[model samples]
Each structure stands twice: as C-alpha cells, then as structure tokens.
Target chain A: MPQITYIEASGQSTTVNVPEGWSLMQGATANGVEGILGECGGSCACATCHCYVDEPWLAKLSAPTEGELEMLENTASERKANSRLACQIKATAALDGMVVHLPESQE
Target chain B: MPMFRFDPYSPLVDADPFPAYKTLRDEHPCFWSEEAGMWILSRYHDIVAAGNDWQTYSSARGNLMTELPGRAGATLGTTDPPRHDRLRGLIQQAFMKRNIESMGDNIRDIARQAAAELKGRKQIEFISDFSSKFTVRVLFAVLGLPMGDEQTVRDKAVLMVQSDPKTRAKGPEHIAAYNWMQDYAAKVIAERRANPTGDMISQFSLAEIDGDKLDEREVLLTTTTLIMAGIESLGGFMSMFALNMVDFTDARRQCVANPALLADAMEESLRYNTSAQRFRRSLQRDVELHGQTMKAGDFVCLAYGAGNRDERQFADPDKYDITRKPRGHLGFGGGVHACLGMAIARLAVRVAFDEFHQVMPEYLRVQEKLDWMPSSTFRSPLKLELSIK
Candidate 1:
C-alpha cells in the first residue's frame, strides 16, 4: 500500500493507505477526510478538491493539466505555486509518504 | 372540459391546436375530468388568477406532478409564499441579473466552441450534440460549477427525474443520480466554505438578511433545484426549438436577419411549444373556481402552454408568429413565486439562438431526431439531429 498523508483543512494530519491507481481526491473523500470535495467526480469541472503538494511529492507527480489550472483559478482558497487539483494527481507506487495540504474551505 | 386527448409530447398534438385551445378556454375555466384525474385551468385569465392566488393555491401541496415516493413538492416553482418568498429572495440575490448578464460572453464563447467541434458535421443529431452541449455550458456557467464531468452529471440527473413504474422500484441509475447530486452539493458547499469568493455558492453560504439564513436542507434543496431546473429546461428546450426552426425556415431567416428577433422567437417558442409544460399546486382552502367547488388538498394543473394558445387571449395563437408581442404567458410563470432564475434560463436559450444564427444559419436543417424522456407533468424533447452535411 502506498501511504499518503492528508493534511486536512483544520491542520490535522492522518496517514492513509492509498492503493495505486486511485486518485488522491477519491482516497481522501472515501476515507471520510471531510475537507476534499470532489464536486465534479474527478472530471476537473470543479476545483473543490484542491490541495497543495508537499515538497518531495511536487517533483514526483505529473504536472497539472490546463483544465485543472483553469478550475483552480476559481477556487476560494489562495492559489499557490504548488496548487494542484487532487483529482488530477493519481496515486502511484512511487508516491509513498506523499503529503498534501487541504485548502481552508470547500464551501 | 373539451377532451381532445392533448399533451404536448403526444404524437397527435399538432403544431397548431388553437381550435382545441379555444374550446378549452370557453368551456373550462376550472374543469375537472375523470380521465385527466385533476382540475385543469386552461384560460389565460384563470391561469394568471391561479398564480396570483397563492394563498389558496399553495405549492407546499406539491407541483402538478407526483414525486417518486420519498420526495414531494418542488424547490422553487411549486412552493407558495412566505417560505417561498424567503427562498426566492436568497436565490435571486445569488443568481442576480448582473451575474447572469456577466456570463453572456462566456455563453457565446461556449456556443462558438461547440460550433467549432460541429463545423464539418452534416446531418447530425442536434439535441445531444448541439443543444445540450450549448445549453449545459451556459448552465454550468450559471451554476458556477466547473465544466468537467458535464455529461455524467447530466445523465445522472435525468435518471433522477424519471418516474416510470420501473423507476419507482429500486433503480440504480435514479438512486445514483440523486446521491451524486447530493454529494456534489455537499462537496461544493465544503469548497466554498474553505475558499470564499464572489461566486453564487460563496454568496449563498455567506449571505444573510436580518440575520436569517437557510437551513441545511434548504441549502441542498436550493442548489440541486437550480442545477436540475437549468439542466432539464435548457436541454429539452433547445432541442424542440431547433426542430421548430428547421421546420420553419422563414422564422429562422427572420431571426438570422435580426438578432433582436430571437427574443421574440424565444417567447413565441415558449408560447407555442413550451419547454416548461405545467406546474401543479394543491388548494389550501375550499375554493370556488369557475363555479366549481375545489376542496382543500386538491391539486390543480396550471397549463401554461394551453393558456398561451387560448384564442380569446392570443390572436392567431397557433401561427408560430414570433412578432406576437407575447404577454401574460405563464411560461416563466407569474405572481410571487415566479422563477427566480428566469433571467438566466431566458438568456441562455436566447444566446443559443443568437449565436447559432451568427455561426451556423443552416443549424435548423436537422438530420434525424431523438425523443426526450416522458414525464406526466412535463414535456421535453431529448434529441435533435442537425444536418451539417
């Protein structure tokens, strides 16, 4: 199991075992993480499932797509250099110990 | 009441049914038929009267259509005042005219994009490819949701609206759509809370008037209501309207010649072949309408389409004349609980017509057509094949 540490909106951190091929958004939402809202069901239409990648994982994951970037611009949270739509970041075996910070709100 | 067995989606329903509408208007101000099983008000005067008399005709009894068991009543269209007033107020503030107008460029831009994808196609289905694509784009813009998973959400939502006997039983698609939308709303609420902005959802979450706000059910219901209303009305609307333009080239040419004529086209279409068919309401008190006593708890159908065609109100009612200066048409409804999102829906549909006229004049030359799913209380054309060939 690839371990992923999700830093929730309230600054609480928990490590969950994310099987490869599952998107980070699905992993966090299914685990009842409470903050990541995949409103568009990983379609990238909604920027609700937004997060900032930890240092090591930023270089490991693929770059954000144009659609995701456009959606991110509408997020209530501040856009960061590492801002990534969680739906776009697929979990892979190489991403063990990966961490991402949840945005302040999904409302 | 004169019974011609007419419903808009019925195959026998002609393009012009003014004679029947006249008979209905003359014979039945508030007539009850055992066959239809509900009292229907078919005259323009009675229709407007019913809408204005919300005190007697409460929406809380539910709209003209029966829900799929667990659910009852409409979110905005079927509810009466007081609570309805508050809900509409909140919704109007969020879905203000300025916001809908701001989306005009985005609406036209989307139509342009869809036109690009459809540039070379010939003899194509207009509804799925053109109308829905264009309609949903504007819908999402108005919804303030992102544009991905558009098809999935639409498909799921459609299933959720079905009320067939099979659907009344445990149905996977119907259940999934409802669950998905609820989940979607919750997710949107969370995101908006985390990152507040000027968007409608953010506005809804933060909005307060006299320190009052919506409860959780009100929030969820309102959000889903807006989404479904836009989705159902627009997709079905453009399909039928496209077919009409295809069949009536003169009207098409007129609209093409004058962008302003499209507004008339929109109104005439709503009058002629309504996308929104009927909204039902139950009587709150024993009321006397047209000399017939309708007791409290009786549901009545306010037939907007029928009233629009009533000869006494509209001269040459069934001629499909866009220049009729349509007035008192219940298409967007009337009185207090009228659609708060009327501006948005009208703008989206008209933009579709205007943009299509500008980009592709031959848009009406359709190839084949598809049927929208049927409902007891509504009529929506599902697909229209456009002939780009």
Candidate 2:
C-alpha cells in the first residue's frame, strides 16, 4: 500500500493508504476524502476529480493520455502546469509519499 | 423441481421485478432468460465487472436487447472503444458539468413554467402534463430546436424504444418512429451544418479532433440518439423519481422540508427505482459465472435495476433512504458506456423538483392500479394521475 496525502482547498489534509492499482481519486473518494467527488467513477469522461500534484512528484507519475488531456480542458477549476486528474494517477510504491492539492470546487 | 422463471418482457415482471431480481441474484446470479433468449446478470458486482470489461462484453454489436434496426455501431451507446472514446470525447464537451450547470437558470425557468401551469388543477396526469412536457421542453431548449413540435417529437421518441411483447421484437410503429427520427435528425444536422448556432447539434456537426470530425451519418445518428434518450429515458427518470416521492412519504417530506436534500433524494430514487432497467452487451469471449457458461457471441442483459437493489452492494437494498448516499450505483449504468447526459439529467431533475415542490407541496396518487410503460429497457408509469390541492 502507498500512502498519499490529500490537501483540501481549505488547508485540511488527510492521508490514506491507497492499495496498489487503485487511482488516487479512488483512494481519496473511498476513504471519505471530501475534496474529490470522482463523479464519473474513475472514468476520464468527467473531470470532477481534478487535483494539483505536489511539484516534486509531478515527473515521477506517468504523463496524462490524450483522453485525459482533452477531459482536463473541461475541468471546473483552473488548470495549472502541475494540474492532473487524480483518476489518471494510479497508486504505486513510487508514489508513497506523494501529496496532491484539491481544487476549490469539482462541480 | 421447477426452474425459476424470469422474463423481462413479461407483464408480471414489468409490474414488479424486484422480487424476481432477488431470486435471480440469490439462486442464479448469471441466469439465462429463455423468453428474451439472453443471459441475465443480476448481481451488483457481476454487472459492474462486466460493464468495466468492455473487451469481454462488447457494446459494438448493440446495447439494447431489442436494438433498433441499423442502430448498432452508429451511436455513442452502441459503439465500443477507441471509436466510442473518440465519439464520446467530441460529444461530451457539450455535456460537461460546467457547461450543463450554466443551463441551470434556463432549466429552472422551464420547470417553473411547467409547475405554474398546474396551479388550479385538482388532479393532474404527471407523465403527460408535467414530466414529459418538462423534459421535452428542456431537451429542445438544449438542442436549440423549435418548441411547437414537441408533441410530435415526444410521441415518436416514446414509440421508438417499444417492442411488441407477442412478437418478441420491435413493432412496425417502432421502426417507423426510428425512421422518422433519423430523417428528422438528418434535417437538423444539415441545417446546423449550414448555419452553425453553437447549440449541441452545431457542436456535434463541427467538433473536430486532429483533422478528423464527425461525418454526416455520425452526426445524424448522434443527434437522433440524444433526442430519443433526452426525451424517453430522461423523462422516464423524472416520472420514476416522482413515483418514488409519492410512494415514500417520509422521504418526500424530508426532501420538501430541506430542499438541499433534493439532490440526494434524486440520487436515492435513481438507485431505488432507476428507469433504465436493462441494457444488453454481446460477449466477445466465452465466460463462466456461477457455473453457467455464456458463450462468445451470446448477448447478456445487465439488469441495472436489479444490481442497484442487491443487498451485497447496499444495506437494506429495497428501502429508499435519502441519506444513504448510494454512490457508484448503476443508476446511470457504469464503465466507459455510462450515461453521457447524466449531469444534464441531474440538474434538470433537481431544478424541476425544486420548482414543483414549491407549487404543489403535497400530492397523492389518484389511481390505485398503475400502468407501466411496455418496454424491457426503460421503466416508468405510463400515466400517473396525482391529486393536487
């Protein structure tokens, strides 16, 4: 299990152990993290699970696919250089100490 | 010992299928339905697994058990991925939550107008007078279609999904409605292509990706699919929710008192009695479940209504609880081929109820014997006469 920290827009932070092969969005939503809605149930169809990756861990994760990039354009929150859909980022041993910032609203 | 019977098309199952679903889930999770000539997956986990594995259970063949002629592989619901992904990507932009939320005021206005019409009525036919009218108007507004022809379009859309129980196939009227909608959609696509107005149809007509765009046939099929789903499926859901409210007075009272709970109530209604009862997927490979082997090329029906009420998934699956927060329920189906207009449907229903409850806070079913729509795929009260004072 890889532990990931989810920091909400209001500065409240919660850490949960995400099982291998589970997406960060799944971990946050399954563990009752308030920030990520995961409305599309981990499908890249809806960009409700928007998040800002911590700067250092950005490069370590896999790059967003074309489908995810297209969906990102529709995110309700502002897109930044490190912005990503948590559903696209699967949990792994490499991302054990990763931190992701939640957007103000997922809509 | 006699084998348990489960026929989706049977009037008995149509009236109340939950008990039969319970039997299927408990005794035969992957039972074969002899009447429909298809495999039925009734358990929650099994349906979800099958939906998620599109490669094993493909939609390219057809999504509907009684699929319309010339429908498979043409529209979003019928197509499998890569192509499905491409079509969805191009079409979903218009249905994004942010985009749909922007139409909130317009939706609310339509709802208000519809609710206002029943101000002095002692009794009202909910499906015809309110739910159908409201959904059709909202869908027309979204598509930028002219309003006067709603009655005609709504009738055709309703008939399009229906099948003849005796024949166990689509009736002539169904095919006629399908053809009419095809011609109607083609006209709309051409008109939108010639004069783009930035509406959903226009967006579909002009949406491009990497120098590729939807062709005329694709645009026509997509438009027709939306119109049919927008009117029949979405309107059916609204009627189902209304029926739930009427049946569950306590839950309804809670929703009325705290308007904020309306969204959750709507979701619970979706889980409790989803209008989308069943959808079919063709098997790409042989699969064994519960000692039954479903061979490749066999069609399997994913009973979403049954899956939502599975005790293994939700506690007290039969009870309608607004506070349950039944997330991940197959109310909107699941996997890559989930309902595309879900956000729109949610916003429309929430706003409609908010406006409706404001006008008629209390109502009851006037008819003791209710008639349900005769369709295997969709379920709703065909006519609901409600007494409103």
Q: Candidate 2, what DockQ?
A: 0.30
How does residue B22 of candidate 2 score in lDDT?
98
Give, for candidate 2 chain A, the lowest lDDT window spanning 10 residues: A21-30
lDDT of 1 by residue, B303-331 (tens): 77788787766778779888775644566
- After best superposition, candidate 2 residue A15: deviation in angstroms? 10
The candidates score, on chain A by TM-score, as follows 0.95, 0.98
- Regions of model 2 farther than 4 Å from truth: A1-35, A41-43, A51-62, A70-83, A89-107
lDDT of 2 at B250: 91
My TM-score estimates for the predictions, one after another, are 0.71, 0.90
Residue pairs whose backbone atoms clash in candidate 2: none
Local accuracy by lDDT, each model: 0.68, 0.87
For all candidates in order, state the fraction of native interface contacts they contain. Answer: 0.00, 0.17
Candidate 1 scores an iRMS of 19.2
- Tens digit per residue, CA lDDT, model 1, A33-80: 767866444545457788999888899988775556767887778889
